[model samples]
Target: MALTLYQEASCGLIAGAAEAYFSFPFVSACLPRVDPTTLSVVLRAKYRNIFDALYSMSANKKISALWTNAGPYVKTRMGTNVGMLTSYNPSLCYLRDSCGLSETRAQLGASAVSAFFGAACSVPVKNVLAQGKSGSSLDCALKILKSRGPLAFFSGFSRQFALVGPPIMILWFAYENVRKL
Candidate 1:
């Protein structure tokens, strides 16, 4: 019952779309807290917590404001999921069979590979979101290109890779082992 790469990508696309749509509001609310520079741009007022932030955003700008960057977020999620899901199993099999790694080591290697690839694919869109710049994804991308150059799209890439890799490794390690039961 193994999935083809296309099937994996399809699954990833649907899952990522749903995840981005459902989570965008909460993510939008929390972003200003983690990246305070966004406060003046996004909220203009500091709230005590996420719920309060959501409430104020909805009140001040309408509920739709919470999804301001939905398209870009969805693109980021889809890229990450497609990159990870498409690569993970083959990477695992290669490490396990060709590299002759132990189960734990194979899972770890595969997850790290998947995470790095996914982060690389998604980080450009993520940078756009993090910047909280107005306009469509294309417009924002163009602005960044004109102002900061292509590398600006990957400004925090190493930090993002570090943040993404370990969680994915832990997840794959745990999930693969448990699924064997």
Candidate 2:
């Protein structure tokens, strides 16, 4: 069963929210810190480490979840939908036309491609948040590239892809099932 556009968007939004909420901490930890002093302070702080880490790892999140979490999550979710569609369309075309796959197989293959693209696109956004930078995403991206090198964008990619892929695949699977109903 094919999902209507609204249903597909809803599924993507829900999945993105869940992914962002659950993965934020781990994603933050994986980013490279510009200030080594911050890491040391957090480590040596013992019981205060959590607070220290949170403060350093995010944009003064102690202030408000809306600024620190929800806002970014929504932005990330919207970005993800764009990334998915960008990748999915091309992958679907390749799978169907080049590989001569059936419609179902093509969709599944395209979805897998979309998941990888979405996860890859998310890395820089996560890096920006982890660094507690309030700049535009482009500015943050350039900062990462300038300060940490091109690889900085992919700092936690392996871990992130491992964590992100399943949920994406599951979301698509569930979306398909729901559309059938």
Candidate 3:
């Protein structure tokens, strides 16, 4: 489970930041505004924030596919996503448990993938919501939750204790700091 606030802040910050950088409105004009009522709402919000951070960080464009499997190295990239994150951080957990790696090595490997996913997740939500979806949307959100193998959405996440957690502590600090300043 993710820290609810980080999930909220991560999504909101990324979306707002991405829009600020790209100068494109990534929100749905007629999508009933945004109401953070459920998990989907939270994720939708996260997508928006991540997008902004991706743009704000000025990260490379090549990793764009990792956001949604649109790149040439998508499989490997996604595999890295699943491989590194599924167990624990790609570095610490994988090496210690899966590959018998040392602490340093596993952390390094996981850090790399974390950077990629962090960047990708930080991407601005380019997919605008339709007034009513011109076509049947694939419910990618649901798909993200349904899979069991390879692209297993967010399942088998025995180790996903904090999907996007620590950043939240930073958020609370920042919130306090900003308000004071």
User: In model 3, which regions exceed 4 Å deviation?
Assistant: 1-91, 124-181
Off by over 4 Å in 2: 1-69, 134-139, 177-181
* Error in Å for residue 179 of model 2: 4.5
lDDT winner between candidates 2 and 3? 2
Q: What TM-score against the true fold does each predicted structure earn? A: 0.73, 0.56, 0.25
Report lDDT (Cα) of residue 45, candidate 3: 26
Model 3: per-residue Cα lDDT over 159-181, one tens digit each: 33254334433443344357668
**Candidate 2, residue 42: how far the Cα is off, in Å:** 14
What is candidate 2's lDDT per residue for 1-181, written digit by digit as tens?
A: 6565566656666766776676666455544434445644333223345556566545545544423435676656655665564666567779999999987888788878888877787766677766656677787777878899988877887776786677776766567668779
- Which candidate gets the maximum lDDT versus the true structure? 1
Q: What residue pairs are clashing in model 1?
A: none
The better candidate by TM-score, 1 or 2, is 1
Worst 10 residues of 3 by lDDT: 123-132
Tell me how many clashing residue pairs each candidate has: 0, 0, 18
Candidate 2 residue-wise lDDT at 135: 75
